[model samples]
Target: MTASSEARETALLAAQAAADKLATDVAIVDVSERLAITDAFVLASAPNERQVQAIVDEVEERLRQHGVKPVRREGVAESRWVLLDFVDVVVHVQHAEERAYYALERLWKDCPTIPFVDRAAPQGDAAAPGTATLSADDIDPASADPTPLAPAPGDGATAGGGPLQDEDPSAPEAAGR
Candidate 1:
């Protein structure tokens, strides 16, 4: 692999390691060859604001330990979305709600998803030294079907219909009754 590719991979792995250390949900998307700015994007989601900050801190600390520094950082105050830009790679740490709202996955859906080896699972049934036992199904979202909920009808419109609803507000009241 080219030096740039190697460096991108190293950054991706480092970000993944940082995410694993914080037990955050993470994904890496390769956008190097496609995008002009970055090579890869490390997306991670935390359960809450605190965890979001923790994940961001862990990622920065871990990458810094490896002599990698982010060129710029954003969205740390609200802790909803923390972006770490390493020039070649960009790491995003977001709260679950914020992640859903922004939908980075959808934004970069066109980019190819890189499959990484699952090292979080336990090695054999026998417990090994310093090894934590985890089921293969634990971290694999593919193991189950995530049923999509249909959007509520007329959600975008007013409760009764539109402007006419105000003229006949009693209609909605009667329906509810």
Candidate 2:
């Protein structure tokens, strides 16, 4: 079975909140068929613990604004990885290191993914069509962009906010000019 529309909507909202906090590698997995506990998973990462916490906070606050609160929260102390369990949708905000090491996407590779686009980001920061979901193997952590979610033109592709192309004027790299 697929995720309920409600779960997908919540997961997308959580993803947008993470993007607002400059989270990277944002993705949503439909785990309803694989897992009975939750319908979907929203995964995102930051370069550091502080940013991870920031992303988590933003996700929580945004979901809360919609009158939805997490039924449980985990791993907030170290900020290496924080999980917000909203029942239908679970948000995972991790440090880049932890994200690369644990590779949650790989663990749930068999599941389908949900596409996300940052509407507030410049057109060039949007992801390419039909390439939203990426596995750990698909990413080279060392080469991954460490900059904020607003991807620079020459940096690389991002989950929701990254340079669309170097030639695009709307690319973040050109925003400075």
Candidate 3:
């Protein structure tokens, strides 16, 4: 059998969210013929632990819009690799090193790949070719002890990255000025 339309839709949305958050090599693998559980798996790679968390958060939020929730999540603490089990679609967002080491793609290489399209970015121009436009959600604002956000290496941005996440977007804060 093949992945149902619902499963495919979820996988695609997950992939798009991952891409929006600067995840790399995002792809969907249909594992229905080999697995009895999920219909497809969405795989993505982040350069660092922070980006890993960011991608995961985006995936969860975007999927939630469709009224879907992950049944289970693992490896969130380490942030080297994270898994989101959304029943029909399982998403794997991994760090660069972990992605190369685990190589889940090789295991499911036989499965046909489902195309991923990021609606927010046309022509695959989500960010500059080599730069990532970090978002406020990149850092966990709800952490027990929140840490400052540092721009990822090679992003060509300062430590502040973009607009202050805490600042109100509607009106510019003139306190510093």
Clashes of each: 0, 0, 0
Residues 1-177, candidate 3: write the lDDT tens digits.
Answer: 999999999999999999989798888999999999989999999999999999999999999998999999999999999999999999999999999999999989999988775555534656643344657767566463457566576554435454455455465453433
Highest-scoring model, TM-score: 2
lDDT of 2 by residue, 42-76 (tens): 99999998899889889999999999999999999
Stretches of model 1 off by over 4 angstroms after superposition: 1-3, 123-177
Candidate 1 has a TM-score of 0.63
Task: Show pairs that collide, candidate 3.
Answer: none
Each candidate structure's TM-score, on Cα atoms with residue i matched to residue i, is 0.63, 0.70, 0.69
Kindly state the number of residue pairs that clash in model 2: 0
Cα displacement (angstroms), candidate 3, residue 51, comes to: 0.4
Candidate 1, position 20, lDDT:
67
Alpha-carbon deviation at 67 in model 1, angstroms: 0.8
- Per-model lDDT: 0.69, 0.86, 0.86
Clash pairs detected, candidate 2:
none
Of 1 and 2, the candidate ranking higher by TM-score: 2
Candidate 2 local Cα displacement, residue 78, angstroms: 0.6
A best-first ranking of the candidates according to their lDDT comes to: 2, 3, 1
